[model samples]
Target: MTGAADRVYAHLGKWAPLYVWLLVVLIALGRTFYLSVNVSNSLPGKLFLVHKGAMPQLGDMAAFRHAGGGGYEAGALFLKRVVGVSGSIVTAKDAGAGFRDYFVDGRFVGRAKPVSRSGEPLKPGPDGAIPPGHYYMAADHPDSFDSRYAAVGWVAQRQIVGKAYRIF
Candidate 1:
């Protein structure tokens, strides 16, 4: 019995590292899967992490692939708040401070300049209303690259990854 106990201990000692490594791998894969299907605003700093599920709604912070027209690199993921959903009226008007104020459903949310930092003209939203199956996204940051510019006018529903909920 003593000899058998010794053999078992020796086997465990030899395989302990392998067991630990396997556990680490499993944990990493689990985390990766979770993050892939989730939204994280913690890239620049640890702000929040949220699960990715269901269609995004108005006022929900969302993650999406950048589908903008020019100057934006392809395959980039962006985080912004959904200010306007389908059928929501969005308008941009000169705010008289060298910026254009953005309004959704007649409520002012934020502002954007008429020119890019590089001196190129930045086009505002269309004169008509927002179309169906589209969203107007924005960030509170003054220099955020969002739907206020012609490059990122309106985000399609299909481009949205998930809605965000603050985790921390």
Candidate 2:
């Protein structure tokens, strides 16, 4: 080989292990700090950055697995706001059983719709203090299929995939 070609090949060989190690570190970080695309109108942003294995906090955006089949696939991952965290008091007000209003720690969360957009009946979520290792997920959108309905009930800690941050 030419002198320059041999020198270039030698340089690459010297740094080959370092380059491989850098690539491996990058792949690990990519898995830990992952990106998610929000596909629903329940949240404001369309792009989200999730910190995998992070514990979800109240009022934080959380990505969890929806035990689906009601307008969603089985084991669908969802992004929603954590309104009621574990050990938080949740109150449900039902006037003549028309529609129930949910409040967490005296703060208004969201209302449970009597029927879905397709006219399917939706049962209200649990009231009183939230159970341990569970959360009430919801959003401002009235049609959001979250913890307010029986379709997506209480979000357990095991079901939470990660804590999400809206990027866009």
Off by over 4 Å in 1: 1-50, 118-120
Candidate 2, 60-160: lDDT as tens digits: 99999988756788688899999888788888888455788888899887888887789877777778778899999998887788887777878889899
**CA lDDT, every model vs. true structure:** 0.71, 0.85
Native-referenced Cα lDDT, model 2: 0.85
lDDT of 2 at 49: 83
Give one digit per residue, the lDDT tens place, for model 1 in 46-137.
Answer: 34344444467888877777875556776677777888888888877878857888888998867888776788777775534788888888
Instruction: List TM-scores for all candidates, in order.
Output: 0.67, 0.78
- Judging by TM-score against the true structure, name the best candidate: 2
Best by lDDT: 2
